[model samples]
Target: MKHPVTPDGRYFAVRCRLWRMVNPDLDEAERSKLTKRLMVARRAVRDAKAARDPEAEAVAHRAVDVAKRALGERGPVWWKDGSPDLNRRIAKNTPYADWYAQVTRSRHGGS
Candidate 1:
């Protein structure tokens, strides 16, 4: 769950994208809380890197990961009974190959 070192702007962009994906009707307070946590995590990452401390960097990475998970990224899907997560694996390599192809075709009109 360690994210590679990147520009602070990149982290902000990610946070923005995740925020956009959240339910629009979600409680404002809850959304603000998650956004704050994400900012803290990103800062930890930046600070740890500046200090050039590997252990602190790892911890910071974990913090970023934890924040992302809480924000419904890179962890369990928030939606109940949603389709199984295939991660980044190719559909043809998993049992959902056929189903994946069918879904893609329907969604993208087979491009």
Candidate 2:
């Protein structure tokens, strides 16, 4: 299937995956916080792409810092990596593992 794209042509699937990795539970508070960071990052990336501006790219870098901090406070292990292999390992062994595994599997149609 063709992936959804933003009006500017950025891939929605990539954005969705990044958003999910940053905040998976759909928690209102968490989503709000990440949304703020993501906005900043998106603006930075957009500006950089438009004008090749290093300063604008820095904003996106800062946004990533904010995201790391937020993700870190929730759990030490959760901040390591957001890849499926790592997430699967954490989910299989941690308290929230079962739910995480189920959700990820269901989303990807994997067993």
Candidate 3:
């Protein structure tokens, strides 16, 4: 499924949050791989927004497809309700809070 995008053109915050959850345990190589995947996905979304390009849309969809497949292949690490855990974890980390705050503030203009 396509990831949800915010009305103001930002990708949903949950996508970033979820992506960060995979960061802690990765080796440098793994982190680089994940970052590259995210960059491709992000660029695809940006391109789609810019011109309604079908190729861009496909790239974004493929990114999610790869992610879901990887998650399934790995088996369940946490339950489906892991969002609460993720939120709590991020809340406890100052860097995460700083990043989240910046993204949110930019997206909503300090609303």
Candidate 4:
């Protein structure tokens, strides 16, 4: 299922917390490439953990970070509006609090 994105399109909410969205400005091809890289790196991480290889796990984690940064999901905020990066913040405690509340209310039939 799709998660709820903030109105400004910079983040999507999962379990009432915000996670930064990818840079929308990236061309589709570039985005796809980075996403694939991220998947591969993620699998590497899993494999390293299962194999109990700490060195390999560290390398894989670095790879994942690189891909995520390239995709604009980590590092710096993709948005240029000067809004602080709220990545991983609880939505209800941030500026998006009212908006998130409204969304959840509507989703639950205005509970």
| Cα-based lDDT for every prediction | 0.56, 0.49, 0.51, 0.94
Q: How would you encode candidate 2's per-residue C-alpha lDDT over 56-92 as one tens digit per residue?
A: 7787777766665474422233433542323222334
**lDDT tens digits, residue span 35-68, model 3:** 6776777677778978888887887978855763
From the highest TM-score down, the ranking of the candidates is 4, 1, 3, 2
- Output the better candidate (1/2) by lDDT: 1
lDDT of model 4, residue 10: 91
Backbone clashes in model 4: 0
Model 4 regions lying over 4 Å from their true place: none
Predicted candidate 4 versus true structure: per-residue lDDT over 1-111, tens digit per residue? 288899899999999999989999999999999999999999999999999999999999999999999999899888878889989999999999999999899888996
Which number leads on lDDT? 4
User: What TM-score, to 2 decimals, does candidate 3 have?
Assistant: 0.40
TM-scores of the candidates in the order shown: 0.53, 0.40, 0.40, 0.95
Residue 110 of model 3: what lDDT?
88
Error of 4 at 56 (Å): 0.7
Q: Model 3, residue 25: what's the lDDT? A: 43
